[model samples]
Target: MDVSGAGGLTDDRVLLGRTSTAERVADILRTRIAEGYFPPGARLSEESIGGALGVSRNTLREAFRLLTHERLLVHELNRGVFVRVLAVGDVDDIYRTRRLVECAVVRGLGQPPFAVDGLAAAVAEGEAAARADDWTGVSTANIHFHRELVALAGSARTDELMRGVLAELRLAFHVVDDPHALHEPYLRRNREILDALRAGERASAERLLARYLDDSRTRVAAAYAQAVDDPAGSAG
Candidate 1:
């Protein structure tokens, strides 16, 4: 997957002209981290990774910095960068914030006249990914669908915060052994919520969304607890 030399570039330059090595490295590493290739509490060694990825230490360091800022990786003084460890409080905070933002969006569902097609498309993508057994893709699509759901409220700040919240929640998904079990059931529920919205059943949609979030929070928390107690049994 290294594209640095694919385009007949001279040793002095990289492919695509403008994409820096650091940026490319960051994207590759981020995708792997999100896909659960790097488990929580796992230590990342710069030199070894650089060698494996065919990059220099400098480029890898820059990539690490990007992930650290995204809160996907944490740097411990002198101990090196490790994937973040999520506590029970992290789970609570993530779900609490999601409920507040998502429910608010639900309450404002029909008042301002919002676009629901984007959410519908995202849900379709999630369904496809689920069918293909691409759990990471399913998680990514699901997050985007819900973010679109929150966008119905018409608040830019809420949108930004919800993205961060979802990113943190994805960490929990990595903790669970079966990503499908955690998210597959919700695909139909999401469709139901959207149906309520399309039918102008605002109150019903709100209620459905609330219950959906509650069930999701419980599943994620239980998975996290199981992972913590039996790390070997959990997914990456």
Candidate 2:
């Protein structure tokens, strides 16, 4: 699953055109990071990745710089860049932002008979992934559900913001010891929110989302802290 080279980067969406090569590299790298292809604290090897993707060092460096600016990667002098490992404070702030933006999106919804087909599909996707024991897929489906929920507002800027935020959130998830325990409980909450939205109960959906994010933030932060505290844990 090393998604580098012709096999990985040559997809229609990932094609590197003559222009925007660096931007395309950034996009590809960003997606890979979000997908947990590169987990938290994973060192990105410029030489191997650049060679695999047929990009120059300059292009790869620029892409890394872009991701670093996004707070997804950190640069350490004499140590190279690695994926960011979130602190407890970072977790709280991320969820606070989520509660603000996600709840606001629900509250801003227009009247009844909402267009929530995408949300419903995402919920089904999570269920299917759970049935298949694909926890990663479940996490992805959860992200999709929230993305679809935000789409209710129809704002490109907000969509872009959540894309980054959720990607960061995924970094925290990548460090958890019990993926099933961390993610399984939330699938039901996703369904409940989706049902509420479909029923045109915006306030109820927003409240559910607020509680969900708050609870998720607390759970994820505690798990991450425990991992960091336990030397044998995989926080690295």
Tell me the alpha-carbon RMSD of every candidate. Answer: 5.9, 3.1
Q: Give, for candidate 1, the lowest lDDT window spanning 10 residues.
A: 1-10
lDDT of 1 by residue, 1-236 (tens): 11222121123243324545886676566545544556677787775566566677887788889778867778889778877878877897889889888998888665634478988898899889988998777887888789789888778888766665666677778777887777888889988987888777888888999999999888888888887788789532
TM-score of every model versus the real structure: 0.72, 0.88
**lDDT (C-alpha) at residue 211 in model 1:** 98
For candidate 2, give the lDDT of residue 44: 77
Question: Which stretches of model 2 miss by more than 4 angstroms?
Answer: 1-18, 231-236
**Per-residue C-alpha lDDT of model 2 across residues 1-236, encoded as one tens digit per residue:** 22223225435343666664776787777777776778887877777777667788898898889888888988889878788988867888888898899999999999989999999999999999999999988988888898888888999899878878888888888877778888898999999998898888989988899999989888888887887678377542
Which 10-residue span in candidate 2 carries the lowest summed lDDT?
Answer: 1-10
For residue 52, model 1's alpha carbon misses the true position, in angstroms, by 14
Q: Which runs of model 1 end up more than 4 angstroms from their true locations? A: 1-39, 42-71, 110-113, 234-236
**Candidate 2 global CA lDDT score:** 0.82
